[model samples]
Target: MKKIKIEPMELNAVKRVYLLGIGGIGMSAIARYYLHYGVPVAGYDRVSSDITQTLEAAGANIHYTDSVGAIPTAFLNREETLVIYTPAIPANHSELEYFRSNGFVLMKRAQVLGLLSSNYKTLAVAGTHGKTTTSTLLAHLLATSMGCDAFLGGISRNYSSNLILADQGKQLLVVEADEYDRSFLTLHPYLAIVTSVDADHLDIYGTYDAVLNAFQEFVSQIKPGGYLVVKQNIAFKPTVGKGVGVITYGFTPDCHYYPTNISIHDGLYRFTLVTPQGSINNLTLGVPGHYNLENAIAASAAALTLGVPTEKLAHGLESFRGVQRRFDVRYRGTKIIYIDDYAHHPSEIEALVRSVREVFPNRKITGIFQPHLYSRTRDFAGEFAAALDKLDKPIITEIYPARELPIEGVTSETIVKLMSNSNAQVVPKAELINWLKCNNVDILLTIGAGDIDRMISEIVNTLEAKENKAINE
Candidate 1:
């Protein structure tokens, strides 16, 4: 069996860090990591976002243009600077070429993160789905009990930042192990958690088996004698590291860790969490939705494995607010209940819609989904349609091409054509606000991973206007 070892970069030698895609969620976190140490930071992003703006305010020199001239003169010294880039950046990018030709040290975002986390005892959460929420909750639990640093995949409502710096001991670091581009392979964590292993990122893995293989390989990197806390019945049975003990958590009673006496009130759930040690009773989840129960279960199991005080469990979980865009409630008006989610996958959409129905029964559900990538739209058009059909009214928006070029026949209408719902239609983002203004909505869900979040404020304002109009009439 081949093993992976990450050699840590000597941070003492590097005077400054330069990032290629500085505005990215993951990239921005790394920039903050550098800034925390008082190291000089500079980067280039394709656009200026709140993330970039925040970085600029924090002593990071950032620009939106891709030109080599945008690079700061001070960072031009090859020996003193380290460059990190996201894989989403195109190969033909001029700035990337300039950095390459000039002999600057370049590493992927994951590689640089590996260098940073290499110093601390790492707790990593990896999966194609369910990782962000689970990791965020895990960070909260540990943060409350014993302070620990975290590099999360989403902006946590509790911390309002993806990077969580421990105020005291930096003994432990929690990281959301990203599977895109096989990036999770960087970490050899003290504890590793696998939340789900569904087929995704086909453009990168090429097949379902490859995705499984990558996950199996990821778990194999767990440190000797550490624990592997995984969801029961997941497809890829991990090949854990030497002396690694496997623990399972799931909805079923057969798992090592599971829930009991599950009950929902209004929208939130209260349940008794069952673990190998003993049962914790009268536990209430801070977030809404039944699907979040699995995520909570997984996080709790990991927390318990790391020796988190059992008494601190319930209070920590009750205070956990959840990650942004992971079933985030934008508006709860008398006329419309709006939720915005970052569910770009078919199975995720199905789960979100199913949970919405569970929470708001008998209410008319309208789902607004933007296809994230043309390749994904081409691959799972039928499945997407089936998931969207679960809603009373489904709106498919124009595809948001994040990193891939548009395919010839794959469009937002592709899913609409395959959908059985008579009310399903295509609405481009340019006219989405107008469509929302004219439409009647009961429980509205704006879903996707791209620029769909940009429309959330406008959609909420439109809903408010409609409510005020009905009152006036």
Candidate 2:
């Protein structure tokens, strides 16, 4: 654990902090952090869930409605409070407008995080899929070695919380740099890791090239004398100045940091970490999934640059329980196994299916997937269909419209039509539970980045019951 000293920004004895979209994993971590600092926190979310209840129980005032009047009186005092919001929020949000018109010091969540990181020894992890897991691993590595305060994108299974180690003494800060809306650009980090530069957020970037350009812009923000670690085979070449050092890490030998002689024993991956200094052998990951191997390599590269000992790095990764919803194994039995993964992009889905095939070489894999956004489905219909077609039996659900309104010609049918596999079917969300009841499942996987999470518990329970009945018989 290493602590970097930051000059404290003086506040005018502000008694309250208000967060819009406070229920989001990243937003909630900030909320919890503010609460830990003894600031009275209050927030508004579009819906109520387990997270909001937890925050409310932990002493923050929360309401589900969007009514501007629902805001607490203390938070409404402009001179003594700060309002923070997420870009996922609709532009026309009433509370946002109220804060704006009233002259309150409103800031984007990324801006606030950037402001926090500017004064600390920050380690920001950026990518399309593995950011959360890599950031969590890096945070755990630093926290165990020295200490770090982290604001992560997913709840770490090890900590059961999205935030970890809030002490100011351990100058290290770990942040998940979200690529959506070009949010990662705000962070100026001491050590930064780019895990993947896949073309995601097409609606925002307009094209794959634009997305790559945004990532390049982000790389330029690395502080002078800082370290930048990038995954191998990424399309773009970064142009950097004198002080910053660049390192490449991946599964291939050309990378400065790569894995050597990888093997899976008893269902756990063991690989030698080949770094610039030397190779560290027999490194094991607590979480399953070969995609995570590359992520671990990337995290290890950055953490080593931050001065974590190779032995400590091995221990931290081995002890990591993984982030929730990233290849999360819910139930396992000899006859039936159920897994859920938050893989929405085509590349992610391909890697996920590949991992499953590798792990269970001879099993029948039945995959159910819910597409995340209408824009994404419309933009990558063929790619999505191709990825889903890889499975033995693929079930499709209606698009989960997170922020965008439904596009005219974009629907589940668009994707189903593109699939060459006849096993694919467009299924309604309501009928899925019953549908699965009658169907046979060997290795079941539910994949997506949307409300598919709402069904995880039910799906797990149903599969568990089937397993129990077979055992009893």
Candidate 3:
């Protein structure tokens, strides 16, 4: 792919910048970006969290309250300050409304990211499931090889940070392209990879076909002469225009890039990677998930296409620790093993459950899942139930209800009722820790996309202490 000159967007020089919803993953990355550049940044979140506190510690003037009056005085200057917000913020948010009423220049997070990426050699990874890990791995490969910068959806266990900024000019920019709100359409990337087009976000998309259409639109925005790496079995056909080459990748033979000679030894997966240039054998991943092998293949293929050698790809893959909350292992012992993952969608949940079953076939798997959104619980209740029913024993928790208002008659009870497993029960999040303390688990797993992650440490401690006491007795 020939690199085209990216005309830089004019950035306003400001003394103080106000972020209306600085707590979002994407918004926080941008906040870090500006703060790293010595820009004075401050913001308000509806609640305080570890992420918000980290931003606060990093010199961002952060407040949990939503009052417009709480905004710093310096950011109130209409002429010099810019207000950035996320689409997740309610339409009637006081701070957002105040910024608009007061003549402040305001922009969505996507628009700002698009403007920033437009000035760089952007490599955008868009998908339903694997965008975070794939983009983070790609960034790791690029940053470790050719100097690069990245904006990631999750904190990299390697960097211990979500935002990876390079001091040098934008030789490469890796971004996790978010499909929510169709934010990825804003990026005109020199390289793009779509891992999956599974039916998701029905609240916004309404149908599977609409979800595919949004992906097609994302492909159209890819710069001409660039490459599009798509997962092999997606329903949509690539309608990329002339000069853009479509490459398919999967476990299948017809894929332009595929994995071969796959094997797992002592929980480590080794595979032979076949690219157009040649094949590399015995490639190992630092992460343990069998599904991650395919993710690594996609990332490595993109890296190889961008001129990274196979050896460097292998080295980077070996060193890649993985993004936080994606099959993150909190505790591992001889008798009791605890794994916590961020798997909200049914497909993701099934994958996590299946992988755990594969790793420990003999042990009885007890999974505790917290449903994420009310819309999703209402939409895919049957699917979620079917997936959770696969485990030996499953416990369903009340829905997290992130952004959407709770729907009438829609709750985790809906999913639990549909499950065939008699063990599946709707448990409150508050009682989870106490329940874990009494329960005897052979292989314990907590899967969710919400605040279930906040309970990981307590769950791990409880399980570990139980195991220790059992061993001593």
Best by TM-score: 1
In model 3, the runs with Cα more than 4 Å from the true position are: 1-12, 167-170
| Candidate 1 TM-score, true structure as reference | 0.97
lDDT tens digits, residue span 429-468, model 3: 8998888887777888889888888787788778878888
TM-score of each: 0.97, 0.96, 0.96
On residues 1-473, what C-alpha lDDT tens digit does candidate 2 reach at each position? 22221223235445678999999988999898888777899999988877888899999999989998899888889877888899888989999999999898888888888887876788899988789999998888888887888999998898888999754475788999999999899888877888888888999999999999998888888889988998888878886655999999987789999988888876678989888899999999887788888888888898888788888998998998898888888888768888888999999999999988887889888999999999999988999999999999999999999999999989999999999999999888888889888899999999998878778889988888877888899
Q: Worst 10-residue stretch by lDDT in candidate 1?
A: 1-10
lDDT of each: 0.89, 0.87, 0.85
How do the residues 98-169 of candidate 1 rate in per-residue lDDT, one tens digit apiece? 989988889999987787787788999998889999999999999988878899898999998999986257
Error of 3 at 417 (Å): 1.4
For candidate 2, give the lDDT of residue 166. Answer: 52
Q: Which residues of candidate 1, in runs, are more than 4 Å off?
A: 1-9
lDDT, residue 110, model 2 = 88
